[model samples]
Target chain A: MKAIITTTGKDKTGILAEITRYISDANCNVEDISQTIMQGNFVMIMMIDLSRSPLGFAEIKEGLDEIASRSELSIHIQRAEIFEQMHHV
Target chain B: MINSKEILETVRMVDAQNLDVRTITMAVSLIDCISDDGKVCAGKVYDKISRYSANLVKVGNDIATEYGIPIVNKRVSVTPVSIVGASSGAFTEIAKALDRAAIENGIDFIGGYSALVQKGLTDAETRFLKTIPETLAATERVCSSVNVASTKAGTNMDAVKMMGEIVLDTARLTADRDSIGCAKFVVFANAVEDNPFMAGAFCGVGEGECTVNVGVSGPGVVEQAIRNIESGDAADLTAVAETVKRTAFKITRAGMLIANEAAKRLGCKFGIIDLSLAPTPTVGDSVAYVLEAMGLESVGCHGTTAALALLNDAVKKGGVMASNHVGGLSGAFIPVSEDLGMISAVERGALSLDKLEAMTCVCSVGLDMIAVPGDTPASVISAIIADECAIGVVNNKTTAVRVVPAIGKGVGDRVDFGGLLGGAPVMKTNAYSAEKFISRGGRIPAPIHSNKN
Candidate 1:
């Protein structure tokens, strides 16, 4: 299964490193990454493969939620197929 | 991979626009549960409902989590109890069984305490119809409906008159709770078999054993999409219709995905995706607001019907392309109490019963969640149902009435059913009597179109 994790907040140092560290620790592979900064606001979308992850969807989401709560950020994890279904024919 | 912007847009629809799978109803057939003895039939009905929907809630939650989309309700729709309980004539017993099974499965409501008497009522069906008022009052989660008219069979004036009295009886029975019982009951014309929303859903005889039906809603998303149109094209109805169609296409596609996933997990057939933009009391999630955003001053004002007609047609056009099977009430809903904008419109006297009736000609369903004075005559209520049925029959569409006669409450008073049922102010009805007309009881013959077949 694949999931898209979105992060949005203020731009800051080491934000990318911190988020990747958590995903790497969970044994998930980040297949694609895109990030942009607009007027000091940071936004990033990561497409990750969860097939090899030891953690369940809920467990992985909770960890990301905890990280988001500790920072000025909003994080959401959703199955990638939802995007494919809605945006494509 | 899908583009980043598209992913973000989908997330925004869920997080901010109130886009959701309104209900994922499992249609369970009770044809095998019929028996000669009332108690034995009721027992079988209970067992079948419980067994089929045992994992409904858990699977709904799992899908919600995985997709990050809110699934508001998990429910069950069974074969009409009148047919299943005809031999036993155990209408109340079967209703009680449905209520218990709904609770056991952790689902909100179980529909199908219903009868199809568009042509005429059978002996057992007539007996079952009379139990509706008491059955609704006795059960908390049992929803009931009666189809009294159809284009092919025309309107059954006899059943229509009976339903009018039944509605009043239900209101009086549950008067202590502001006549909440009527909120769980509906009267229909040209009723669809696979409707997932209630109090109108029932597994018609035409349906197979079991299937998953999904009703998706996204009025807020549609409203916002129209709002985002360039100012240069703001006054253009063509642009508005285009925007609405595109948004509805996206919403319906999401629904198809959820319906397929739910049926796969539940080991049932994927029945259909009800392409309806159903509203909720939540502020932005209103169908009325969608119309208002399309440049209407109020939902009931003069051009309201035109705006609603455009919206309803655009939704179906867009939705039909996204889903393989688009059934149920596939258009924009305009229920008063369940929509914040509609409630506001009524409070300001900008909306009225007459205007609502006109609007129903273009909406997915008819005069829903409206409240009238307790003193409103049963004949007048029947007249209202008959008029709405006439529109559905002539136009070849489905329409229904779920009005609540607020017992002991007069005009200007409000009846609150809370949660998704919402609340509505008691609006005045026409004072003229329809007693003589109602007294002429018989089937309103099928329309001329019926002869074509």
Candidate 2:
């Protein structure tokens, strides 16, 4: 299964490195990356393949809990079908 | 590649706005389970439900986890028990067994403890009908419905009268619980098969052996879509329609994905997607709030029906294209007790039973979840059913009445069902008696045919 990681909040240093580190540690590969700053608020979306990931979806979510709270960002990881189905059709 | 803006937007829609798949219902036909012996029939009924839908809740949860959209309810709808148990007279005897099956399978509610008597009732049907109060009072998770009218068959006034009295009996039977038993019972005109929503959903004989269906709900998301832009004059009504259409498309798409995945996993037939903007007691998740977001000062005002017509049509237009099949009462549901917006609208006198009757002409259900005075006569309930059925029969649309006769509670009081059924504010009803009309029990013939619009 493929999933999307969306991060939205105020911008700060080392945000990309922090999120990618977690993804890499989970043995997931990021196939696509899109990041931008909209009106001083940072927004980033990473498309990752999770079929071979070492950590399960729930465990990986738990692994990212600390950084999310510390950064005061709203981060969500969801199956990509939600976006694919809604936006395309 | 899917973009970031839509991703965050969808997440926000779920995180803040209440966008959910209202139900993932597995319709298991109990025709094969019918037996002349009542005890044998009950055993087969329980076995079939438990065996077929054992994985329903698990699959529902797995889909919710994978898609990250809240799947609010997992339910089962079966073949109407009346026809299944006609010869046995053990109709009420089956309620507890079905309830046990529901609990064992972890299902929220099981529907289709029902009968269809639009044209006429047999001896078995009439006997089965009288057992409804006991069925409802006895079962913990079973819901009941009866179809008393249809366009082709006309209105069954005799059945209507009996159901009115039955509705009262159900209320009085469960009076200690604020007459919550009536909340589980609904009277329908032109009731459709394959409905996935509870208190009305049933698996018709025409349906296949087994089918899985979905009901999608997203009133708050539509409200957010409209609130994103300015609410202009009548000229902007077109824009409102377009916005609602687009929002419904997305909501229905999400529901379809869940239904398809669940069916694929369980090896069941994928049935229709019911595209309805069903509301809950939650603050922002309400159909009345969507109307307010459309710039209607109040829901039951002069322009309310027009606004609702736009909503109902656009929902169908957008929803039809997103899913392979669409069935059920695929429109907006306006149950007063289940919606905070409608409840407050009634409490403030901004909405009335008369206005709700008018609104139902353009929406999916009629006089739903409304609380009337304890002293309301059975004839009055039958009269209300007659008027609503006339609308459905004439317009060729589905309408229903699910009013609660809250015993010992008059107008200005409230009956709370907690959870999903929510709480209803007792609203003013017409005092005029319809005893003479209802007492003359005879069928109202079908309406004249009209061409497709």
Candidate 3:
């Protein structure tokens, strides 16, 4: 399954490193990455393939949520199909 | 890959604009649960609901987490209990069972403790209607609705008269709770079978064994979308309608995805998506605010009905093609208590009961979640229902009355139900009595348009 992981917060050091390390540890593959600064905040969108991950979708979300709460960032991991359904169709 | 901006837009809609699947309602038909013995039937009803919807909450939560969108409620709607419990005359007992099942399964509210007496009533239905007040007061999560009129059958003046007394009785019974019982009951004209919103949803006789209907809401999203339009073009009604339609299409598409996935996961037939811009008490997430954003000084002002008409029509136009099946009360909801802007308008003395009645002609529902003075008579309440029914019947649309007569309370007072049910200021009803009209108990003949056959 493919999903999108979006991270948004104030600019901080090692933000990408922290996220990628966590993603790799979960056995998920990053398919694409886009990062930018918008309206004075750091924004990153990662399209990730979760087919290889042993962890369930809920478990992965919980881990991401823990990172978000600790780092004061807004993080969301959602099935990519939702975007395709909303935007493409 | 989807563009970055569109991805963030979806995220912002949820994170900032309160876009959500308002409800994931599993409609369970209780036709097979019927038994001549009321107790036996009640047992079967409970068992079927508990078994069929055992995974509803879990699946709803799972989808909410996976999709990163809020699923506000997980509820169940069953075949009208009046039909299921009629043979046994065990209406209240079945109400208890529905309430128990709701609590046990972690469901929000169980609907369809209802009857369909649009033309006339049978002895069993009449007996069942009498149990509503006590039953509503007794149950914690059971919701009741009565269909007293329809375009095809005209209006049942007798049922309307009875419902008026029943609404007051319910208010007095639950007076301690700010007459909250009335919040769980609604009277409708031209009620739909597939409505996922409550307290009006019921798995109608025409529905299949089981289905999953999704209600999507995003008043804030639509409001923000309109607000995002350039200020110069904001004055243009055509531009406003276009924006609303496009926003509605996106919202409905998301709803379609959720509904189909929920049904697939729950192993049930997929029902329609209700594209209602339902409001919450939160400041930015209000349907009234959407109207206000459309250049209205206040929601109940002179041009409010026209604005609501355009809004309601555009929503259906945009949403119809996004989902294969679109049913339920699919338009803008203006439940005063559940909308912060509406509550504020009433408090500011800008909105009134008469204006609300006029607004319902073009909106999704009628006189919803409004509170009236305790001294209001049942005949007046019946007259109110009759007026709304006349609008619905004559116009071939659905209208409903869910007014709460706050016992011991008068105009300007507030009755709070908290959470999504919110609260409302007790508005004044007219001083005139309609006892004579309501006393002439019979059916109002069907409108001429309804004579299609």
Tens-digit lDDT string for candidate 3 (B388-411): 999999999999999999999998
lDDT (10s digit) by residue, model 2, range B1-453: 787778987898898899989999999899988889999999999999999988999888877877888899999999999988986778977777789999999999999999999999989899889999988998889999999999888999999989889999999999999999999899899999999998998899999988999999999999889888774444388888998999889888888888899899878999999999999999789999999888889888889988889999999988997887989988899999999999888988899899999999999777799898877899998898899999888988999999899999999999999998999988777898888889889898877673334
Residue B172 deviation, candidate 2, in Å? 0.8
Colliding pairs, model 1: none
Give the TM-score of candidate 3 (chain A): 0.97
Here the TM-score of candidate 1's chain B is 0.99
List the DockQ of the predictions in order: 0.82, 0.74, 0.91
How do the candidates rank by TM-score, highest first?
3, 1, 2
lDDT of 1 by residue, B381-449 (tens): 999999999999988999999999999999999999999999999998998898999989998888898
Q: Docking category for candidate 2?
A: medium
Model 3, C-alpha of B403: deviation from truth (Å): 0.4
Clashing residue pairs, backbone N/CA/C < 3 A, model 2: none
Q: Candidate 2, what DockQ?
A: 0.74
**Model 1, residue A31: C-alpha shift (Å):** 0.6
**Residue-by-residue lDDT tens digits, candidate 3, A1-89:** 99999999999998899999999999999999999998889999999999999999999998998999999999999999999989996
